[model samples]
Target: MSVTRVELAGRSYEVRVGSGLLEDVAVQCGPLLRKQAVPIITDANVAAYWQEAVTGSLTAAGFEPHFLVLDPGEATKSWQVLEQVVDWLLDQEVERGDHILALGGGVIGDLTGFAAAILKRGCGFIQLPTTLLAQVDSSVGGKTAINTRAGKNLVGAFHQPSLVLADLDALATLPSREMGAGYAEVIKYGILGDHAFFAWCEENGAKVVAGDAAAQEYAVDQSVAAKARIVAQDERETTGTRALLNLGHTFGHALEAETGFSDRLLHGEAVALGMVLAARFSARKGYISQDDAARICAAIGNALLTTEIASLDLSCRGADLVAHMLHDKKMDAGTLPFILLRGIGEAFVDKHVDLAEVGAFLDEELAR
Candidate 1:
C-alpha cells in the first residue's frame, strides 16, 4: 500500500492506497478509534458488496460498527437525505469526537462527509473511497457537500478526514461505464496543472483503464499527490490557487444543471466535456494555439473522456447551456468566472471574462 498525507493547519489525514485496505481498516483506525464506536454510512448497493467485510474488520478491532443504509443515487445526496443521515447518527448516539466512516463511491462519500461535518457541530470521519474518482480526488480534499436546487455542491463544508483508504480491489467491481466516469478525473489532474503526469497518463491510461494493477496504483498515487499539494496550499479555497482544480467544473456543473443533475450527465463526464470546452475556449481566446488545444483533446481522447462526454447527443444548444450557468457558484455580481488555459498544464481563473462572450462561444461549439 502507498500511504500519503495531506498536511493542513490543524487538520491532517493519511490517504492509504492499495488492495484490500478495507480488511485493514480497523488497524488503520486503531489510533483514531480510541473508545470511539464507528458508524458506517453507505447505501444498499455498496452494502451488498462491502458490509460484511467492513463490519467484521471494525468489530474484530474492538470498534463497534453501526450502519445507516440509505437509498441509492444522486437524488440521495440531498438535504432530505442528509436529514435522514443526521437523524440516524443521532439514533446511533454518535458523539462529536467519534468518527463516521463514509463507505462507498463519491455520492456516499460526499453525503456522509457533509453529514459528518455538520453532525454535533463538526465531528470526525474517514473516507473508504471505493471508486477511482473518489480515491484520487473527492475523498482527500475535505470538500464535503450536498447539491442544492441552485447547483451541484452549493451546500457544503471543508471537513478533512482522519484517514482515507483507497482500496484498488474495490474498483474491480465497478461497471465499465462507471470506470470510464472515474478515468475522467484522473485525466483531469494531468490536464489541469501537471504536464509530466499528463504525458504519463497518455502513455499508460489505456492500461490503467484496463485495470492493470501497476497502472491503477500509479494513477491513484499521482492524482492524490497532485490534489494534496493543491489542498495543502489552499485548504479552504480561500485563495484562487486551489480554484484551479475547478478546471472543467464550471462548464461541467453548468452541464449538470442543464441536465437536472440526473443520469443524463455524470459529474466526471461533465468534467470531461467541460475540460474539452475549456481547452477549446482557451484556443478561441488566443491564449493557447490550436495545436496545444489539439494535444489536450488528444490526451483526453486517449483516456476516453471526450467520447464519454460526447455520449450525450449534440442536442442541447450552447445558449441553453449558458442558461444553466446562471446559478453557478463562481458567478459574482452577475458575471461568471471561468478556469481557462493558456496551454497544456497551465490553468488560470478568468474573472474579467464577459458572460456574453462565453455564451457566444458556447453557441459556436453547439452549432458545430
Candidate 2:
C-alpha cells in the first residue's frame, strides 16, 4: 500500500491507494471509528456490488455499520436528495466527532461530503471512492458540491475528508464505458501538467483500463500526488494554483448542461471532448501550434474517448452552451476564467477571454 498525504493549512489527511483496503477499513480508519455503528452513505449501484465486503468488514471489526443508499448518478446531487441524505444522517444522530463514510463513486462522494459539510455546522467524513474518476480526482480535493438546476456543482462547500481509502480492487467490477470515462480524468492530469506522465499514459492507459495492477497503481498514485501538491498550495482555491485542475471542466460542464447532466455524456467523457475543444480553442487563439492541438485530440482518440462534440447531438447552438457557462460556479464578478493550454502539460488560467469570441468559437465547433 502506498500513502500520499495532503497537507493543508491547519489539517492534513492521507490518501491510501491499494487493493482490498475496504476489507480492512476498521484498521485503516483507526480511532475515527468511535462508535460501534458507523454511518455510511452510498448509492444503490455501489451497494449492489460492494455492500457485502464493506458491511461484513465492519461487522467483523466489532462495528455495526449502517448505510443510507441513494439512487445513483448526477440527479442524486440535487436539493431533494441532499435533503434526504441530511435527514438520514440526522436520524442516525451523526456527531461531529464521528466520521461518516462515503462509499461509492463521485456522486456519492460529493453528496456525502456536502452533507458532512453542512451537518451540524460541519462534521467529519471519510471518502471510500470506488471509481477511477473519484479515486484520482474528486476524492482528494476538499471541493464537495451538488448540482443545482442553474448549473453543475453550483451548490456545494469546501469540506475535506478525514481519510481517502481508494481501494483499487473496487474498480475490477466497473463497466468498460465507466472505466473509459475515468481515464479522461487521468489524461487531464497529464494535459494540465506533467508532460512525462502524459506520455506514460499515452503508452499505458489501455493497460490501466485493462486492470493491470501496476499500471493502475501508478496512474492513480501519480494523479493523486499531482492533486495533493496542488491542493496543499491552494486548499480553498483562493490562488490560481488549484484552478489549473479545471483544465477541461469549464467546457465539460457546459456539455453536461446541454445533456441535462444525464448518462448520455458522462462527466469524464464530456471532459475528454472538452479538453479537445480547449486544445483547439487554444490553437484558434494562436497560443499553441496546430500540431499540439492535433496531438491532444489524437491522444484522446487513442484512449477511445470522444474528440468531436458533433457526435453528441447537442440540441443547442454554441451561444446556448456559452449561456450555460455563464452560470458556472467559477464565475467571478461576471468574468469567467477559462483554463486553456499553451502546450501539453502547460495549462494557464485565461481571464481575458472574450465571451463573444468564445460563443462564436463554440458556434464553429458545433457546426463541425
Candidate 3:
C-alpha cells in the first residue's frame, strides 16, 4: 500500500492506494466514524458489485450500514438527484461531525460530497473511489460538483474528503472502454507538467490499462501526489497555479456540451481529444512546433482514443461549439481562459483568447 497526503494545514488528509482496501474498509474508516450507523451513498452499478463486501465488513465491525443506491450516469449529478441525496442524508440523522462514505466513481463521489458539504452546513465525508478516473483525479481534489443545464460541474463546492481510499482491485471489473476513459486522466498529469512522467506514460500506458499491478500502483500514487501538491498550494483556486489542472477541460467541456453530455463522449475521452486540440492549437499559435503537436496526438491515438473532432460526426459548426464556452465556469470578465500547451509537459493559461479566432481554428479542426 502506498499513501499520498494532501497537505492542507489543519485539513490535511491521506489518500491510500492499494489492493484489498475495500475488503478492509471497516478497519480503515473505523477512526472516522462517530457512531454505529454509517451512511453510504453509491450508484446502483457499484452497489451491484461492491455492496456485499462493504456491508459485510461494516457489519462485522458492529456498525449498522445504511445505503442509498442511486441510478448510475452523468445525469445523476443533477439538481433533482442532489435534492434526493440531501434528503436521504438528513433522514440518516447525520450530523456535522459524522463522516459519510462515497463508495463509487466520480458521480457518486461528487454527489455524496456535495450532500456532505451542505448537510448541517458541512459534515465530513470519505472517498472510496472505485474508478481509475476518480482515484487519479477527482477523489483527491475536493472539487465536488453536479452538472447543470448550463454546463458540467457548474454547481459545486470545494469540499475535501476526510480520507480517500483508492482500491486497485476495483479496476479488474471495469469495462475496456471505461479503462480507456480513465487512462485519459492518468495521462493528463503528465501533459500538464511533468515531461519525464509523460514519457513514462507513453511507454507504460498500455501496461497500466492492461491491469498490471505495479504499473497501476505507480500511476495512481504519482498522479495523487502531483495533485496533492497542487491542491495544497491553491485549495480554492485563488491563484492561477491550480488552474493548470484543467489542461484540457475547457475544450473537453465544450465537446461534452455538443454531445448532450452523454456516453457518446466520456469526460476522459473528450479530454484525450481536447488535449490533442489544445496541442494542435498551440502549434497554430506558434507556441509549439507541429511535430510536438503530432507527438501529443500520436501518444493519445496509441492509447486507442480518438484524436480528431472530425470523427465525432457533429452537425454543428465550430462557432456553435465556441458558443458553448460562453457558459464555462472558468470564464472571467467575459474572457474565457484556455489551458494551452507551450510544449510537451508545459501548459499555461491564456486568458486573452479571442473567441472569433478560436472559432475559426476550431472550424478548420472540425472539417479536418
lDDT of each candidate versus the true structure: 0.84, 0.92, 0.92
- For candidate 1, the TM-score is 0.96
In the predicted model 1, the residue pairs found to clash are none
User: Looking at model 2, which ten-residue stretch has the lowest summed lDDT?
Assistant: 25-34
How many clashes in each structure?
Answer: 0, 0, 0
| lDDT of each residue in 25-76, candidate 2, tens digit only | 8889867888898998999999998888888888888899898988988899
Tens-digit lDDT track of model 3 for 1-368:
98988999799999999999999999999999989999999988999899999999999999999999999888899999999999988898999999999999988999999988888899999999999999999999899999998999999999999999999999998887777888899888898999999999999888888888889889998899999999999999889879998988888999999999899999889988889989988999999999989988888887788999989999998899899889999988888999998889899999888889999999999999
Q: Whole-model lDDT for model 1 versus the true structure?
A: 0.84
Model 1: per-residue Cα lDDT over 1-368, one tens digit each: 88888988777888998888888888877777756467899989888899999988888877778888888778888999999999998998888888888999899999999998899898899899888888888998899989988888889888888899999999887876677778888988887798888889889887777788889999999999989999999997778889999988888888888778898777778887888889988999999999888887787677666533345665676677778787787777887778999878889989877767888888777656
User: How high is each candidate's TM-score?
Assistant: 0.96, 0.99, 0.99
What's the distance in Å from true for residue 358, model 2?
1.2
Q: Supply the global lDDT for candidate 2.
A: 0.92
